[model samples]
Target: MSERPYVLLSCAASIDGYIDDNTDERLLLSNDEDFDRVDEVRASCDAIMVGANTIRRDNPRLLVRAQQRREDRVNRGLPETPIKVTFTSRGDLDPQAQFFAAGDIEKIVFCASSAVDKCRDRLSGVATVVDAGNPVDLTAVLAELAARGSDD
Candidate 1:
C-alpha cells in the first residue's frame, strides 16, 4: 500500500475558536507577517486542501502571492503553486469560484460517493472529482494524494 501523505492542518481561528462569524465579509484573522509566513508554508507544500465551504465563502485564489516563492518552487522543479484540493459532501460548488478559475495547476475535489456524479457533471473541465466513499474517507484521500506524488 502506498504511504499516506503528510497532512498539514493550517488555519487561522480566533481565541474563541471561531474562524468566522455570520458576516458576508471574511474575517481578518491574520496580519501581514502572518500572511507572509503562511505563504512560505504554502510554497513548501505539494498541495493545499480546504473544505468546500471555505471555497464558497472565502473565494480565495489559493496562490502563492510572492513571485520569488513561486519562482523558487519552479526552480525546484515544482509547479508555480501547489495543487488545489477541496472536499465536499453535497457537491454544491461553484465552477466559477476562484479556486477553479485562478490556478493553472490541477484542481481536485473529493466528494461523497453519492455526490460524485453530480460533482463531476458540475465541475466538468474545472476539476477532477473523486469518490471519497460515502462518508468521504480522509485516509483514502491522503493515500490517493500520496500515490500521485503529493506526499510532501
Candidate 2:
C-alpha cells in the first residue's frame, strides 16, 4: 500500500456550485470525461468520500464502471471497488438506499455515538455503519480506516 493521507477529499458539483437543484432532486452535471476522471481518481485512491446529503440525494454507488478505471485499478492492485465512505454526524443514513445496495464491496458509514443506536440497525446487506464515538469525528474515522491497512 502506498503511504497517503487517510482522507481522500472529492466532490461532484455542477458548473454553478450546486451538487443538486432546489427541489431535493439529484443533479449530475459532470460530463462523461469528468466522470471518467473521477473514476480514475477513485481507482487510485483508497476511499471515496461524501457528505450525508450527497449520499441521500444522489445515492451514488461510488464505483468505477468505466473500462479505463477498471484497468487502472488492475494496474494499481487497488481492488475492483473503492472504499465508499460517508460522513454523517447523526448516523441518519438509510441502509436500504441504492447507495448501500450498489456496492460490490462493503460500505462504511461513519457516525457519532448519538447516531450509533440509529446506525446499529437497518443497515444490512454488504454494508456496516461504524460509530466513531462522540462528536462524529471524520478525522478519527479516517485514521481508523488508515490503520486498518487502506493505502490512502
RMSD of each: 1.5, 2.6
CA lDDT of every candidate: 0.93, 0.72
Q: Residue-wise lDDT of candidate 1 within 1-152, one digit each (tens)?
A: 34987788888998889978887998999999999999999999999998999899889999999999999999999999999999999999999999999979999999999999989999999998999999999888998999888976
How much lDDT does candidate 2 score? 0.72
| Over 4 Å off, model 2 | 1-8, 12-20
Clashes of each: 0, 0
Question: How many residue-pair clashes does candidate 2 contain?
Answer: 0
My TM-score estimates for the predictions, one after another, are: 0.94, 0.81
Task: Write candidate 2's Cα lDDT for 2-64 as tens digits.
Answer: 334545566777666776677766666788998787777777777777788877877777777
Score candidate 1 by TM-score against the native.
Answer: 0.94
Report the number of the highest-lDDT candidate: 1
lDDT of 1: 0.93
